[model samples]
Target chain A: MDDPEYRAGIIDLLGALAVGELTAFQRLAADAELAPTRADQAALAGMAVAEFHHFEQIRDRLTELGVALDDAMTPFHEPYVAFHANTAPSNWLEGLVKAYVGDQIATDFYREIAATVDDDTRALVNDVLAEAGHADFVVDRVRAAIDEDPSVAGRLALWGRRLVGEALAQAQRVAADRDALTAIIVGAPGRPGMDLAELGQVLSRLTENHAQRMAKLGLSS
Target chain B: MDDPEYRAGIIDLLGALAVGELTAFQRLAADAELAPTRADQAALAGMAVAEFHHFEQIRDRLTELGVALDDAMTPFHEPYVAFHANTAPSNWLEGLVKAYVGDQIATDFYREIAATVDDDTRALVNDVLAEAGHADFVVDRVRAAIDEDPSVAGRLALWGRRLVGEALAQAQRVAADRDALTAIIVGAPGRPGMDLAELGQVLSRLTENHAQRMAKLGLSS
Candidate 1:
C-alpha cells in the first residue's frame, strides 16, 4: 500500500472504470431513442441515469485522490470509443442485449480486479458494479422480442457474441496500453496480484457469467 | 379539489410535464455527443440525468393519482417531438444555447401553472422545475465561446429565438389539443382559472424571463 506504483495502479484502474461508466451512460441514453414505446424509452433512460450515478461515484473518488479527472480519464478514451463503435447496436433489442451482456462482462472483470485492491477501493468498485435493477428490464425486453419472433433469437445470439468479443478486445487493448492498470491485476513490485492461473480462472468466470446472462435473455452465447 | 373536472385537468397537466421532462432527458443526452470535451459531455449528461429525476417525480405523482403512465404521457409526445425537431441544434454552442434557453422557458411556464394547481401538485412541480445547477456551466461555456468568437453570438441568439418559438408553438398545440390541460389554466366550471388579462400577463412574464436567460448567455432573445 506504501508503494507509489500501487497507488498509481489504483488510480489507473479507477480512471478506467469511471470513464467506462460514463460511456455506458452515453450509449444507453442514445439507445433509448431506438425504443419502440415511451415506456421502453424511459426505462432505458432510467438505466442510463443509473450509469451516470455510478460514473459520478467513481469520479468523486478520483477527485478525492487528487487526480485531475481529464488526465486520468484521457488514456482509456480511445479504447472505449473503439469498443462502442465496433458493437453499435442496430435496433432496440440489440441495444438491450448489448447493455446487459456487455455491462455484465465488464462488471465481472472489474469485480475480479477489485478483490486484489485495498478495502476502500474494493468497496467502491462493488458499489458501482452492483446491479441497478436494469437486468430484469433488459431481460424482459429481449426475451419478449425473441418470443414475438423466434427467428430474431439467432440474430440476437450472434449480437451477444459480438458484444462479448468486442468488449474483450477493447479490454485487452486497455491492459496492454495502461501498465499501471494491468499491474493492479497482474502484480506490481511488493504487491500481491493475480497469478497466471488465477487470471485464467477470472477469465473463465467472466465468460461463464456472460453465458448465464445471455441464457437469461434466452440467447445462446 | 373535489371536482372531477379539476382532478382530470391536474392529471392532464402532470402527464404533459412528465413526458416533457422525459424528452428533455433524451434530448440533453443526445446533445451530449456534440460536446467538445469529456468534461463537457459529462456535464451535459449530468443535466440529462437531473431531467430524468424530474420525470420520475412527475410520473410517480401521476401514478399516485391512478393515471396510467403512458396514457398521461401519450397526449403530449407529438408536441414535444415537433418542438425538438423544429429546434434541433446544429453545433455544440447551439446545443448549449437551446438547452439553457429552452429548459428555462419550459421551467418558467410550469412554475406559473404549478402556482394554480393544488398544494401537493404545486410542490411536486416546483421540486422538478428547480434548477439543477447546470445554468452556470452553460452560461460559462456560451459566454466564453461568444468572447472567443463574437460571430457565434449572432447564430446562437437566432438559435435561442427559434427554440422559444418552437417551444411556444408546440405548447399552443398542446393547449389547443388537450382541453383538460387548457381548462386547468384558462378555467373550469366553478374553478378559478386565469382570466384573459392574467393569461396575457403570464405570457409577458415568460417572455421576460426568456430574454433575461438569453442575455445571461450573451445572446439576444
Candidate 2:
C-alpha cells in the first residue's frame, strides 16, 4: 500500500484473478451442460461452484482493500473474456480438456505470482487456487474417452494446444495493457522479482506442467 | 424400507428433488450469463452453486438408502427436463422471475409432501429446500428492472403466469405417472396424508404464496 506502483500491481493482479474466476464459473457451468450424464454434469457444475467461491474471495478482498470490486476488475475483463470466446470448446471432450488445461495454467500462474505478493495476499492466493479435486475427475473422464476412441486423442491434443495458445495470448495482452502489473511480475526498479531469463523459466514451467496434465489425460501436449 | 409403497414413494420424492436441483443449477448458471454486470452474474452463480449442493445432498441420501442414484432419479427426469425446455426464459428478467417462482413452488410442494415421509427424510427435504438468500437477490433485481421500465412489469407478470402454469402442468404430469408417489401424497389406504380437500387447500396455498411473491416483485400475479 505504500508504493503506488506496487499497490497498483497487486490490485491489478487480484483484479485479473477476480475477473478470471468469474468467467471460469460461467464457462464451467456452460460446459457442464455438455456433460453426457447427470453425474458428470453434477461433477463439472460443482467445479464451477468452487470457482464462484474463489471469485467471491477475491472480490471481497478487493472491497476490504478499499477498491471498488467492479472498477478493480474492469482492466482485465476484456482480455479474459476474449480468451474464453476465442477458445470456446467444440464439444464435450473439448470442454473437459479446456476446463482441465485452462484451470491448470491459471492455477500455476497464480501460484507463481503469489511469491511476489505480501504474506497475507500470498496465502489467500494459494488457498483459493487449490484445484478442489476437480483434476482427478477431469483426468478420469478424458482418459476414458480416449480409451473408448483412440482417434479422439489427436483432436483433444490439438484442442489442448489451442487452449494453451489462447490462454498465453490473452495473458500477454493483459500484461501489455497493465504496465504496473507487468512491472510487478518482472520486478519494479528496486523490488525483488523475475528478471527476463527467470520469466522465461516461469513460462517453461507453466508449459511443462501443461504437458504433464495432457499426458495424464492420455493426450499429447 | 419394509413397505414397498412407502419405499417407492421415498425414492420418487428424493429423485424428483435431485432432478429439480440439477436443472435449477443449470438454469440459474445460464441465466447468470445474461446478467448485465459481473456482480449480478456472481450473485446468481452463487445461487446456482447452492442448488448444486442440494443436488449432491439428495443424491448422497439416495445412495445411503441403498437406491441406485440414477435409477432413483430417472422417474422424474423427463418431467423436470420437459418443464425447463418448455418454459425456458427468453431474457434475464424472465429467467430471474422463473427461478424465484419456480423454486418457491417446488419448495412448497416438497414441504407439503414432507409431511407424509419419515422424520429423517422430512428433515433432509426441509433442509435442502431452504433458499440460500437467492430470493432476496432475485426480488431486488426484478423490482429494480420494473422500476427502470414499468412496461417490463406487464411482460414479466405474463412470464410469471406462464411459469406457474407450466410448473403446475408438469407437477400434474409427474403425479399422474408416478402412482406410488401420488398415492403417498394423497395418502395410502390408512396412511396419514393429504386428503383430496386438503390437497385442494395445498394448491390454494401454493398459488397464494406465488401471488405474494409476485406482489413483492412489483408484478401482478
lDDT of 1 at A151: 100
TM-score of chain A of each: 0.98, 0.98
lDDT string for model 2 (B1-221, tens) is 68899899989999999999998998888888787777877788888889999999998999899887678877887898899999888898888888888888889989999987889999999999986877898999898888888999999989989888899899989988999899878878767777789989988998899899999999998
Give the distance in Å from residue A39's predicted Cα in candidate 1 to where it truly belongs. Answer: 2.1
> Tens digit of lDDT per residue, candidate 2, span A164-213?
88888998888888898887778878887888898898989998998998
Q: Residues A1-221, candidate 1: write the lDDT tens digits.
A: 47888888888888899889999998999898888888888998898899999999998998898888888888988899899989888899888988888888889989999999999999999999998887998888888887889999999988888888888889888888888888888886767788989988998898888888888989888
Judge candidate 2 at residue A6 and give its lDDT: 91
TM per prediction: 0.96, 0.96
Q: What is the docking quality class of candidate 1?
A: medium
Per-residue lDDT of B2 in model 1: 78
Clashing pairs counted in every model: 0, 0
